[model samples]
Target: MLKVQEIRELIKLIDESHIDEFSYETNGTKVSMKKNGGQIITETPTETKPATPQKPQPVQEEELKPQEEVVEKKDQETAAEQSSNYDQEITSPMVGTFYQSPSPDQGAYVQVGDQVKQDSVVCIVEAMKLFNEIEAEVSGEVVEILVKDGELVEYGQPMFRVKTV
Candidate 1:
């Protein structure tokens, strides 16, 4: 379980960073916080559930190797291949799962050829089950969507490449 002081520090760090929200759970305690009105709002519920023991499942080497290769290869190619002087990248502000839309059934927030202004919400990055709205930091035409939906993205992972308008 995390102490109040530690939680406050974590919130401070998040506030200073680009992360929009954070969540953590351990030892029957859960905490969820979000940036609201330039202040941190933390919610702690009193209800707790008993911990359950589970057997660990072994990961298949074939499955794991391909995923690792794909991620590394893509990151390298994205860094070296497409960007030009006039292009700008919209990168993941935090390590989390990349989502193009708010929900599975909804249409994507931005697609290739879409025009976006600075501060336009282009996607979501969900960490620890807390979905954060990610905004485009530049005004431009979205030339490409760099990441597929539901992919685990690292901090600074490029999500979109935009051509300045």
Candidate 2:
């Protein structure tokens, strides 16, 4: 497993390099990381391959068609569930340091399960030595907080999950 510091360094390198994709292989462990539309997707492929003997008989074309249809339906259901759980996600407007409070001595702007109105301040993001307050774009209950205080955040990354009112 990779340490937290290593992951942090990787994120810093990614930001500094402005690279959309990166892959690393070490000790037989391979990890592929990519950022698309602000979403970070990671994929890891196992090094082991299954050993099996294949039959020479050919599969029927009509029989295989139904299997394909079943797989397609399953994929559609999975996609729909992902979208329905979070009504609207508040994403990072710019790459910066995410701060949950006005200052280190203050309470957080908002916490999980808090009710917020449109334009309510939820957090602050500091970029290039300037601190910018982030506001909720819709009125709702915050279902989740995606980033920790003082953590570096990327542009377009999901920061809050709000269930619309």
Model 2 agreement with the true structure over 93-118: per-residue lDDT tens digits: 67899999998999998998999897
Weakest ten-residue segment in model 2 by summed lDDT: 42-51
> How high a TM-score does candidate 1 get?
0.53
Top candidate by TM-score: 1
Candidate 2 global TM-score: 0.52
Looking at model 1, which ten-residue stretch has the lowest summed lDDT?
42-51
Instruction: Write model 1 residue lDDT over 40-151, tens digit each, in one string.
Output: 3322221132223411212344558889999999988976777563389888767889999999999999999999998788998898887788888799899888798999
**Model 1 off-target regions past 4 Å?**
1-81
Candidate 2 ranges beyond 4 A from true positions: 1-84
